[model samples]
Target: MRIVKVMSVVLCSLGIAFAAMAKDMNVGFVYVSPIGDAGYSFAHDKGRLAVEEMDGVKTAYVESVKEGPDSERVILNMARKGYDIIFATSFGYMDPMLKVAKQFPNTVFMHCSGFKKAENMSNYFGRMYQARYLSGMVAGAMTKSKILGYVAAFPIPEVIRGINAFTLGAQAVNPEVSVRVVWTKTWYDPATEKEAAKSLLDAGADVIAQHQDSPGPQEAAQEKGVYSIGYNSDMSTFAPKSHLTAPVWNWAPYYKQIVNQVKEGTWKAESAWPGMDAGIVKLAPFGPMVPQDVQDTVTAKQTEIASGAFKVFSGPVKDQQGAVKIADGTVANDETLLGMTWFVEGVVGTTE
Candidate 1:
């Protein structure tokens, strides 16, 4: 009887230990749009779900938080609630996140697609331009009008770099192709974005690509019977007939890495820009309309990119004014790419 009682006591102690360990970690995410938007925030929410799968870790998120003061309030509240790690997934949240990090030294902060950092804050973004360039190759091959339209969110370096890369890739496949840009200035407004796509369609664009958070552009392309490329996630389901491909984010791997680092006590504040090689970004599968030849060519280029054998921003790259931005035999470095504020030669748009 005494031996059985001692065994029960040992089991009770193990249960208490397990409960303590389970309460050790809490992670929070702040999103600029609702997860149902099926775009950028949806992709980030997938990453948060991945983090939740880890043992002894719990995750929570507040979505549709505006980028300015709303973001700052949400982040500060999460920190105050004892969230060990907070991820603010939007470019405009950079300054606000930096402000919050100063007050919470023990909490880890990660901002997406931004350039600012603090002692307890880090910034991260995927090299999505590489995949965008590949999608442009597909659009260039299929376009009969040789004119592609882009629905852009903002004129920040991230959007500008993607436009330049897409243009370069299209030009590589079809040197005669040109891209037109229309800015919506709002990230998740469907009506404005669809109107922008319609304007591009009216301007004789046979193919449309977008750096936006809504499927509105895709819907516009479909209604017009034109081809389109998507962003942030695979949007084929929205416009299967029109979607040729997309440059998508796979944040699970990177998010898991960060969570593991924090749990292991080895995390530090640094900028992380993982690319195709790291499986952080990729080109979505081709639609049925994409010819086998085009698919094969894109796949070959994707392989080269993944192996680091080909750099997307290799020069003799020219600006919209026919002036050289990157000389021949030179590959554009991260600093140049990060601060890009001008369009490439084949693009028709004002940076402002």
Candidate 2:
């Protein structure tokens, strides 16, 4: 098949368009980790499945390609191979994706967890902080030590905003609660992630939250007999007894939306950060460990958040050193939240 671009109309699997035949659109996925990792990358792969299951969409993915130079090669190869749309699923893939996108303007490209946007390019990510905030609600009620730990993956604003949301949610329920942070700086290094969790557990934390893809923190929490929360996917399998809840991403809906738009000639640049209402962000099953009352409270708060009546990062916020980050009655908007760099009050020093 020629590596040429499709126009407004999409081909059906049976050589026709939507006349009871499968739509034959080629879609591609570029992953930061393998789908079998059962964490961040796994979730994105699930989304690829969502696309494949669609009537006319066929999906292919390249896994474990590192960022930078390798990313450029990966995008070029996929486009050269005739993939209709390529989805770059890592923050670091931003520059490479942009470069390749310029070269292949006919190909539709989507980058997740990135901040860039262009005519033929769009950005998509969920308001995972909403789920993080809900999980912190459980951590607040369950912690007996009044200390919660967060294992962070990087210092980016996305990660930083999550830390703030988690801390703010915990303190909202328990005034005495303090969050201790440990930045591993590596996304999937099990050893570094586990060591970071161990350090926090040693510091008197009774519950843990994490942005890393591995279940190391949840596993460590189980060993320490403390409750835990997860990211990207439900990690309860790693620590059944220690599980609380998780901030799982539901990219399937978004994928379906974009692909259908592409197949219909209605595609356009769009940015989305949907929360609970939009169903893009969701809370994994709460373990039997969390009490009903606590679950009820979190459910109610989530409703408010979905309805725009509640904001986890509403202003009148402060940093760890007691500096005001958001003045009174001020809410932290998307710009501020995306650029956040400071830890809020109640977090201990960096675990590093």
Candidate 3:
């Protein structure tokens, strides 16, 4: 009787150990750009680091993966290697991830800044325009020329939406301010981005803003003795003289929640677009050059936004052609915001 009891206890212990081993997850990440000091991929990599801090999770990543066939191959390799979850952190990886997800249905896939999803795949992004608008206010208040230069990436809805929000925020504070955009057609080219910034500076823009991934624009502004706004992460470190503020991303919280869902077996394929209220998107600290009154005003507005008392895309908004796109008292819905293709009034650029 004693021997049988001991045997039973040993079997139970073994079962518990096996269950713990089964809970271990192998996660992977695919980055379109090098996880340099700062930028979009660097921000996502920070999220991956947060996930690693959790129990029973192992992480791996392949950075600077080109967004075409190379990304598909890399994703398929990770899925085959038994990665339980994979995050494709680029807009162009949407189709590649979708195709790989179909083949590896058991492995969950998450794509950032894209619209495609599958039974085992999901998409996630933040309403970064909220932060963009606030940064625009800073530019409008600081610019002597009233001409803000925006160095842009591709002319997708994401870029267009940000530019419009910045322009709208500037016009709200300084009615004479106008934004001029120059596209780089690349997300992470420092040389091209800097040249674009210089071109804008030469064209009478006293302030510079950007949607590109590098701090080249900020550096350019610093060299030219002008103020600049940054994106993806705080760029003040790169351009102390010119950095005003940035609309930064904090991806750690969202990553931790998603990993927990996967571990608890509650993971589902859905689209998530969180905003300031969720702490997914935020503004970097103001530069020393920003005035106290300007900081107070921005803080007041930021509080209103976080508490849901104000909406950035509320109506009475118009396009550059003087035609009202959103009538007064009527707010634009998520669908309209996501599919935005026109510039707001006071913006001088073509979507094409």
- Backbone clash count, each prediction separately: 0, 4, 0
lDDT tens digits, residue span 1-352, model 3: 9999777545533433343358688889999888893888888898999999998899999998988899999999999998888999889999999999888757789999999897678999999999999999899999999999999999999999999999988987999999999999998999999999999999999999999888999999999999999999988899998999999999999988888777766677799999999999989999999999999999898888889898999999999999999999998998999899999999988998
Q: Residue pairs in steric clash, candidate 1?
A: none
Deviation from native of the Cα of residue 331 in model 1, angstroms: 0.6
The top-ranked prediction according to lDDT is 1
Model 2: residues >4 Å from true position, as ranges? Answer: 1-23, 350-352
For each candidate in the order shown, give its overall lDDT on alpha carbons. Answer: 0.91, 0.83, 0.90
lDDT of 2: 0.83
Alpha-carbon RMSD, each predicted model:
8.5, 5.0, 7.4
TM-score of each: 0.94, 0.92, 0.93
- Backbone-clash count (model 1): 0
Shift of residue 328 alpha carbon in model 2, Å: 1.9
Model 1 per-residue lDDT tens digits across residues 1-352: 9999777545533433333345668899999999999899999999999989988789999999998999999999998998888999999999999999888767789999998886578999999999999999999999999999999999999999999999999999999999999999988998899999999999999999999999999999999999999999999999999999999999999998988777665676889999999999999889999999999999999999999999999989999999999999999999999999999998999998
TM-score of 3: 0.93
lDDT of the structure predicted as candidate 1: 0.91
Question: Once superposed on the true structure, which residue ranges of model 1 sit more than 4 Å away at CA?
Answer: 1-22
Error of 1 at 51 (Å): 1.0
